[model samples]
Target: MNHSRAILTLAWREILRFLRQRNRVIGAVGQPVLFWLLFGAGLESTFRLGESGQSFRDYYFPGSFMLILLFTAIFTSISIIEDRKEGFLQSVLVSPVPRWGIVLGKVLGGTTLALLQGLLFLSFLFFTEMRPGLFEIGQLIFLAGIAAFGMTSLGFVLAWRLDSTQGFHAIMNLLLMPMWLLSGAFFPIPSLENGSFLLHWIMRCNPMSYAVSGVRQQMDGSFLTADLAADYWFPSLSLCWAVTILFSLLMFSWAWKTSSRRVQGDLR
Candidate 1:
């Protein structure tokens, strides 16, 4: 098969598999809404948005959207483990397709699912009192797609090496969950009085921090506000986009490398 055809075939299969699973749809789209309603409402009064006087729910809108993308990416990538066990992956490995095509197909499949769910979550913004202009809506779509691509690629890399879905879950909870929490999705980077310099450094190092920050910047156009932008400790919007794109490329390369190594080892 040609490279493009191989990629499309794999991606189409993933999309069909995802659509056939009703529970996956509910879990991907429903849980994020539940979390937003429950946690966001609970914290709205207690957690203020700096001096802007915005409620936590308004501030958390972007994060919740990111959560949808993250969850979808996680579940979609986990299918790799199942495919491996069922010998489907081995069949693909032995096919005439390039390893990069396989990686692109899988990553793009997960990314497509993530972006779809993330956009669905966007419809809830009206209830949250957020009405983005046409330009802002476009920006949200662009940023959401980029974030989903990078995150799904990251999950692909992890799932590519794993043998079990349970193991993927454990590692995801340990890695992805904390990455979200620290990405300023749930809370602002803590003040020095309430947090440590090390914690601040860690947040800066997290690539997802830029993803979250990029989404926030797109949604609110907060980059125009100098003081407000500085308060949150997120990178600049351009920086966020650059870092996120770099991250996506790096993760895609890593997954391709890992898959190539696996194919070589199997031949040996």
Candidate 2:
């Protein structure tokens, strides 16, 4: 089998599957934009007084965009579970393509979906906010690309062992909510006076925190004007991206190896 050709074919199939379900694409991209347009604007009065003092629209717009990417990653993983349930995954496993290639294609396909949705969200944001220049637009797109890959990688890891869509949804909800909340996407971590030392520490350690901070800094107004060091923000997000990708590789490799071993054992 031509490995690259098989991967391209599989990835194309996945993209077409997503595209055919036009509602999924629309809902995936539209919800976040609607949230930022309605709820974020309504909350603008509240978030404006926080450390960054950004209008809620500006503050939530990027985070809202992040949520769109996040949801797309999680939702796309559901397709994997659905395939497994329908024996589609087993069929793919019997194909001539290498297991690693199959995994890579799925990850890339999902990342592409997430990035497309992010672009749509960012377009809305750009139209609504007048101050962001070409550089800021570029920066946001760059950040969104990194984040979609990171989140898709993470989702691919979580989907590796799941056999049912319900199981995937259960696990995703368990993992996703805390990650969103502790990440400081909604509001900046104020100070120890507001929480216990451990809670504060967890927020500091949350990878989503790094993603949000990197994105927030690139907004029309820097989310906070305290003059965050570029060194700090850039490295933190890079680390988050690295960590997400590393975990994904580890997970995919494990799944591929385990499945291959199972096949070999069955042959015996």
Candidate 3:
């Protein structure tokens, strides 16, 4: 079969598997709602200004959507390990398709799945008054697609070395928590008291920090208008897209190298 056909067939099979077991899809779309509803409601009255003037709900809602994309991407990576265990990898290896195509197919399929969940969440948020504006809604969807790709690349790397579900989950959890917390997804990064060096470092180093910042800029209506003239802004959404694409490429390269090394038993 042609590489394109192979990828489409694999992607279709994965979508069908998701349909047959809709719980995973439902859960992926549901948790974000629960967060927006429960957590947003609880803190709606309390959370305060991070210089955006958006209320707690407004600020954190985008973060919740990011959370959904993050979770979906990493979980989808587990399919690599699953395929290996189920003999699916053997079938793919026998095919004429390149090994990179196998990884690319999985990433495309998984990221598409994540984007679907993201759209559903955005739709829910719009209808519920948790968010507003048709343009903003569309922008959110676009950003979600970007986030899904970034996450899928990260997942590819995680699964490349992880042999067991437990190990994958552990490394994923470790990576996920720090990335999420440090990215200003849950709380304001600049608001952190100048006492903790480690948190300050993590906040500076995490790339997710830029992503969350971008989403927050959109949510708070600060994209073109500078709230703080000194604070670095990407200058345009085009830059944001370029930055994300570049970052995703770097991640894919790293993950591909890791996978190749492991396949040759050059890495432990």
Candidate 4:
């Protein structure tokens, strides 16, 4: 089959598999909701957003949405390790499909799955009573899609070389979890008075920070504009988009190169 068809077929398989796994769906959606409610309520009184009086739940809505995407991307890409262990990935590698096609198919499959899960979390806006404009909602979804693609690609690259699922989980917990934590998802970049220069610099350097910022800026542009004196930190929307796009392309290229090496090693 042609590359485009191959990619779509692989992506469809991912979507079908996701639908069949009811537990995965429940965990992906449930965990974030629990966090949003438990933490949002626990901190609502104590966590203040300057003089604007926004509750912690209001501030955390975008972060909770991001957690959905993160979990979905991690879970979806873990299937690669399963496929490798089952010998399915090896069979695909030996097929006539180019290495890039294989990588693209798997990455796009995970990306699409992740994006869908993120969209599901968007429904919570109704509970929050947020009435963003249609254009704002569209922009938020577009940014979420790009962020999901980049995150899924990163997971794909990490899982590509691993032989065991346990190791993948460990690496993801150690790396990916921190990426989200430091991305300003749970809180604003901490002030220097409360955090060191190193901690501040790390958040500034994290690409996921831009992804979270992009989503938040798109969703809460007016609120953020009116609260200019607030201590919250986020890069400009243009810069966030640029960094997210560059990060996605970089991760995709790395995964493609890794897949090529795997094919070569298997053939030899």
Candidate 1 on 29-88: residue-level lDDT in tens? 898899999988898779876556667888888889999999998899998888888778
1-268 in candidate 3: lDDT tens per residue? Answer: 4688887777676667767877887677787778877877898888755354556677677788788888788878887787777767667766788766766777777788888887677665553334446786677567667777778888888887766889998987787867887776787554234336666666756777667766665554542234432332222455555666677778777766665544521222
Could you report the Cα RMSD, in angstroms, for every candidate shown?
2.3, 4.1, 3.7, 2.2
- Candidate 2 lDDT, tens digit per residue, 158-177? 67666667877788779886
Model 2 clash pairs are none
lDDT of 1 at 14: 85
Candidate 4 residues 231-260, lDDT tens each? Answer: 555688899999999998898888888777
Q: Tell me which of candidates 1 and 3 scores higher on TM-score.
A: 1
- lDDT leader: 1
TM-score, model 2 to reference: 0.81
If both were scored by lDDT, which would come out higher, candidate 1 or candidate 2? 1
TM-score of each model, in listed order: 0.93, 0.81, 0.84, 0.93
| Span of 10 residues, lowest total lDDT, candidate 2 | 226-235
Q: How do all the candidates rank in terms of lDDT, highest first? A: 1, 4, 3, 2
Reference-based lDDT, residue 45, model 3: 81
Off by over 4 Å in 2: 49-52, 127-130, 191-195, 227-268
In candidate 3, which residue ranges exceed 4 Å CA deviation? 50-52, 127-136, 191-198, 220-239, 262-268
Model 3 lDDT, residue 50, Cα: 37
State candidate 4's TM-score: 0.93
